[model samples]
Target: MMKARIHQRPKSSMQSGKAKVGQWLLDYEPAEAKRLDPLTGWAGSGDTSAQVRLAFDDLDSAVAYATAKGIDYDVVRLGANPLKLQAYADNFK
Candidate 1:
């Protein structure tokens, strides 16, 4: 059976803006461990499904799609969203 993971897009560590933070993502799990090519010395795998990523607007849709396709998936839910309000002047204090 195909295995997949469904989770929300994480907040960017480089920027503060929360744009597209909640978008759900479906990613296939790697079926086999990557092996190093003896000739080129490059790490690669034959499982191309691991490269596919499907975006969903919400968790429900992502779950539905996985169920319809008979894919075994695990949903990773994030903790409660916490917004900390602060002022620029507070940075100096």
Candidate 2:
């Protein structure tokens, strides 16, 4: 069975306007083992699911997609949105 995670995107550390903060993301955990390349010694997995990231406007849509695909997912809820408004001019103060 494939394991997935559903969560909201974390706020940017830059304290910019919350333009894309409301989006939710669905990510899959890798079910494959990483193999080291003998030539370059680079480690990587062949699992394409690990590379897929589906974004949704709402939490329900993210969960619904996971259910339709038979994927077992864990929803991680983020803390309340940050309310500390900042301004570029404040940096100079």
Top candidate when judged by TM-score against the true structure: 1
Clash list (residue pairs), candidate 2: none
lDDT, candidate 2, 1-93, per-residue tens? 999999998878898578778899999999999999999999998899999999999999999999999999999997765687689899999
lDDT of 1 by residue, 1-93 (tens): 999999999999899899988799999999999999999999999999989999999999999999999999999988886978699999999
TM accuracy, model 1: 0.85
Q: Model 2: number of clashes? A: 0
For model 2, what is the error of residue 10's alpha carbon versus the real structure, in angstroms, after optimal superposition?
A: 1.1
**Cα RMSD to the true fold for all candidates:** 2.1, 2.9
- Output the TM-score of candidate 2: 0.79
Clashing pairs in 1: none
Which candidate's lDDT is highest? 1
